[model samples]
Target: MIAVILMLSRGSHSRSHKLKSRALICSVLLWMSTAVMTRSSSTSDLKSKISGVEELLEEFRKQLQQDESGSREDEEDGDRCISGFKAAEERIIRASASIEQGAAFLSAPQRVFSWRDCAHACCSHPHCTAAIIQEDLKQPDDSLRCYLFNCTYRGRSVCSFSFQPGFSTYSRVNNSSRPHEPGRGSTATDSPSLDEPPRSDAGQDLVVQLPTDWAVLDGRDSTDDHDIIHYEWALVKGDPSVKMKVTHPGLLKLSGLREGIYTFELTVTDTSGQKSSDNVSVSVLAPAPNAEGQKLFVYIFLDYF
Candidate 1:
């Protein structure tokens, strides 16, 4: 009976050891599964974050491209506007070549605008086929008048335009159907007939006989202000010894003149500091043979008397 009891105790100890071993194996398996699940969750989160960053980067790139394209388009439009207006100015000037001194055409309502503003205004207006800028000599530099016209009118002198000087006209060609009527909405009146003669006293070439001794060269400007007038003379060509002495405003004296063709320039400056120059050609003629014989007789009579 003692041997049977010892054997039963050894069997019970072996079963307990087996059960403890099985529990330790189960705990190890549960720990490993928990670690794998945590690792998988971290990988998925990292991938999702990377995808979000890539999408954001793509969006930013697209926006940058759009901004660059828009900037280029704006620059192109500005260039075209300037070029168009410049072309118009050239065309109008050529068309109004018949007018002397200043150009006059059938113009639209006058608008106070700058060169660039005038260009944009012409582009925007439906009836405006052309544009012109006329500067007021009496007004300051900042004050400029813009005239828009649908049709061009040429063959008018500055006198017909109410003595207004410094008028410039510009035009743009439209391929659309039907051009606007001339003088319909024109603020400027109809110019007088071309048959009318221009003013004789108006600025013209000076033709005079060279003096035998000292010749007084007189230059006159019709400017309203005489106090602010500044006179300048320069010998453009001909005799080098010829000298110009400025006596006063619009007055020059030639002291050392010879018998030859001499070209002299007379520049007049106004109160606004605007300068205008006119070239005068002087012709000096030698004394005639008959004049010397007549002078000798007159001198003999004077001596005898």
Candidate 2:
């Protein structure tokens, strides 16, 4: 009975050790599975982020390419304009008198391989009457600035200054269309000098009240011979060819006006029935957001007064 009891104890101890060994193995396998899953999740997240960044980079590159292509198309179209002159042939005016001032608009410095390239750019633009090439001595040989200008009635293309070093001006001369002076040039047009249209104070922007306003249109004769006896006011910009109602003595009372841009044309007639016209632009601004409150205050004050 004692030996049998000892044998039973040994069997129980062995069974407990085997059970503990199985539990340890199960724990190690679970830990390894968790670590592998975590690694795989981390790698997947990294790959996703990298893919998003690449897509964004590709989109940015496409946008840049589109912009560059549009710019190239604009350059090819040759839509550049200077000084309101168009389709005029470029004539090289070497060491011309006008320097410095007189440019209606000055363009930013453009890179030109040679002087001829600058001239070609000027000629291609419809508004470019003259171009001045300025050399940038500090930069490379291709660095040049192109200045555009409109030829004033006076002989001065730019300013009265003398020739400047490292600068040359090229002017657009319209031989086919320009009216030739009788004494100054070989051929002369049939139009007489006296028949030149009278000058008026127009081409200026104006602002006025909405719904109702008083305006004045005055006409003056350049000859000052009291010959400008007739005046007419017309609308050219707003509502298209509408005529303005005229009060006596060149006073214009504008009424029924909405918020918009309006252009008024004035033509004055001399005794010889010669008419000269000018245009003025008027802009009607929209009422401010606080206009109603201010208007109520004004009405109250006016009633009290």
Candidate 3:
């Protein structure tokens, strides 16, 4: 009986040890499976984030390319105007200078940030053959002021140079254009060379019939070495009721005339602002009776006799 009891107790102990070993193995397997699943999920999330970053980088690259292309186009446009122009150092003109007799401003003075910008402005204008730029010491950015002009007197370039502090002059280089010759001993104090004024020709006086109430005043023969830019007509002594119309520059049409003497003065200005004046007279006479009407009246009187 004692041996049988011992055998039963040993068997129970062996069975309990086998169950505990199986439980330990199952716990290890569960832990390893959970660890593998967690690692895989983390790897998928990392790949998604990497894809997002790559897409953003591509967009940024495309934007950068577009910006570069636009910048290149802007540079090309700016180059078109400033390419054939050259600048003269330390030579410019003042607004109040006596140079106004031989030159006229192409436009109002413009404020710019650099001399290059001023030069570009001058080149852009069709009539601008020269330009002057001066730095403004009062401005915080040290900005520049630009003045554009054709600088011609009697069809010749009157662009003379003188010493001016913080000033530069720019002129176009063209085979057809004349070179600007600086005057000898030209200084800030000396007066610039002057040119002859334009000549105005309000053509020969006219005689018109009273039935014809209109006259055409011709000033097309006005003479200027530089081109004529403006023509002004005034009724110095005429019928105040007369109407004057400018058909074009240096040409005028007069209307509302009567049997009287009408006098007009033509003042012509050239590109260099030099002007000359001349006068013309138009005499409107009473119209003669119609010859046919007089003959008809004579026939009617003969029939009455």
Candidate 4:
């Protein structure tokens, strides 16, 4: 595939490399235009593109990392803008190289108290753009999950992970696509990774008469995949728990939560070492009025999911 692509590319590496520099300057314009033009890609494809962008950035950092000598700098200085295809090429090269030389596999790190523990690790690691599960050849899905590190141009999967035997059997939890959305990231195509839910605003209403508030306390997903929500929240201005003001997730039976917008969150680190977080806004207010003629009291509540 890459060979075909290379043949189709208009210029030689030298010329292409120079153009790459220009691409960097126009990256913003290109990104916006691309977003408008490529909305047809599936949700998964979009995720892949975003991941690809992050991968390029990470690979770029590693690529630019230098030794004391100036020789390496000169070799890479020619190409600055990261192309999606080039990034893909680098992965192929690294995966291939890993296959030739012995590769060291790493077990997924432990100490994850909850999902958040593992989620943070993946988010922080540059090489670890996506995550996959480590499986026993015989059991596959039944096997334990592990992290999948980003592969390089020279190392193939088998060659790179042969030594450690830990990274050998794994499945990715994040997409490897190009970047589309700057503020959001793909957790995994279908895997139960952490994802911020759409902020719900239905709960806030003037009819609540009495002030109220609401929140997700150790929320669970509908199927435990995208359904559960483990969150930490504070009344940024009022009490750490809740302000006397109205907010979302209004008035819990046990606590004095009230009428206003409220935030909820859940972070998870998968067995594969990939981690993600979900920040959702839930609306809270006095239940809809029994009848229509209620005095509506509008309250401005600040909440972070």
Candidates by TM-score, descending order: 3, 1, 2, 4
For candidate 1, lDDT tens digit of each residue in 213-291?
3565566633322233566778787778877787876676876667777777767665555455667777776655587
Superior candidate under lDDT, 3 versus 4: 3
TM-score of each: 0.39, 0.34, 0.44, 0.23
> Taking the tens digit of each residue's C-alpha lDDT, what string does model 2 give over 230-279?
77777777754333566764445566556778888777776767666677
**lDDT of each model, Cα atoms only?**
0.54, 0.55, 0.74, 0.37
For model 3, residues 1-305, the per-residue Cα lDDT tens digits are 34544444455556677576556556666777788888988998999999999999999999999999888866765664465567788887554442444555667455698877887777566556677887788988777888886665555656666887788888775411222222232222353443446778899999999799999999999888657889999998878999889998878999889998988999999887878889999999999899999999999999999
Question: RMSD (Cα, Å) of candidate 4?
Answer: 32.7
In candidate 4, position 176 carries an lDDT of: 31
Off by over 4 Å in 3: 1-41, 65-83, 93-104, 123-127, 136-141, 150-166, 175-215, 219-252, 257-305
Candidate 3 — what's its lDDT? 0.74
Of the two candidates 1 and 3, the one with more favorable TM-score, higher being better, is 3
Q: Which has the greatest TM-score? A: 3
Model 4 lDDT-worst window of ten: 81-90
Q: What is the TM-score of candidate 1?
A: 0.39
Evaluation by TM-score, superior candidate among 1 and 2: 1
> Worst 10-residue stretch by lDDT in candidate 2?
175-184
Relative to the true structure, candidate 3 has a C-alpha RMSD (angstroms) of 15.2
